[model samples]
Target: MTFTYQMTVEDAVSFQKELIHHTEEHERRRKVWMKYMRAILIGIGYVGTLFFPYRPESTALHILTAVTVGFLFALLLTPLLNDLYAPYMLRLNRRFLQKSQTWPKETTLQFYETHVEVHSVSTNIHRTTQVPWASIKKVNEDETYRFLYYEEDEALIIPKARQGISEAEQLEIDQTLEKYLSTSPNV
Candidate 1:
């Protein structure tokens, strides 16, 4: 199944919000390179604890070991800060696009067995892009729209509620996408 519809600036704004949310989700689920850093830090901290004498004769060295471990532990805990800031960044993105901006006035979409080709048309822009199934890392949906997330900067948003697609039709489309994309929608 294919959908050809032009999205309004409001829809674009919603797309932006979903992108932000998807980013946060990706960060949470994606591979964390920090694990290696944390392991190295812990190992160094442990070495310090083992080599340094913990006696009154070596008070400064004992303090140095404690400080090193504390500092490294602090560094290990820094990723949690991003979780705290994600919601704030999401809110800021919503506020940033308070004014409506122009989006593609029309789009031509062709859903294939494992890819979707997009031809974009707007007053200012005209381009065609092909996104393969492998590039689609995630499929997400909200109450009103389904988002096919390719990357942080690219996604295809289908307005499920606006099209007034019948439930049977929606189910069939869902099954088709699920078959190719390997992710099922909550729709």
Candidate 2:
């Protein structure tokens, strides 16, 4: 079977966001620590607000307040900033790291018995990659896309809205992926 779709910077950023969400869900200890840290920062902020006009004798409190506020600002703002900056960062990474300036290009995937071939083409670049079925570490899907993850942080994004991907085709792809991935020890 074959499927083709547009791959854009927006798709890359969305994948990054999805990866972050997935990581957060799986990292329970990290989430717990972040929650505790947020609580500590908020408590410090409250204490600092209560003693805003610190006397000369309260030099330590003034310093603590300054430190706590800085941490609080970073803790609260980092995710927001990341969301805002991710698109630009992905674009830059594509241009410099991947050395591809043209994106939002057509990507085609062809599934064979033993491997999947991916072809991506733009004005200045044309590339094809063949991934053996055994090399796929995982197959995951959300509402809008199917992710064929070959590594922890990398995947082949197959958008469900692509023209050739009908419901039956999706089911076939899912079955094919399941058949291959279920046999792989890494998954």
Tell me, by lDDT, which candidate is best.
2
Q: What is the lDDT of residue 146 in candidate 2?
A: 71
Q: Candidate 1's residue-wise lDDT over 134-164, tens digit each? A: 8887777888778887886678876665554
Report the lDDT of model 2 for residue 173.
73
Question: Among these predicted structures, which one has the highest TM-score?
Answer: 2
What's the C-alpha lDDT at position 21 in model 1? Answer: 54
Cα lDDT of model 2 by residue, 10-63, tens digit: 666567655655553425634554566566666666566556665445768766
Give the 10-residue window scoring lowest on summed lDDT in candidate 2: 81-90
What is candidate 1's CA lDDT for residue 8?
A: 66
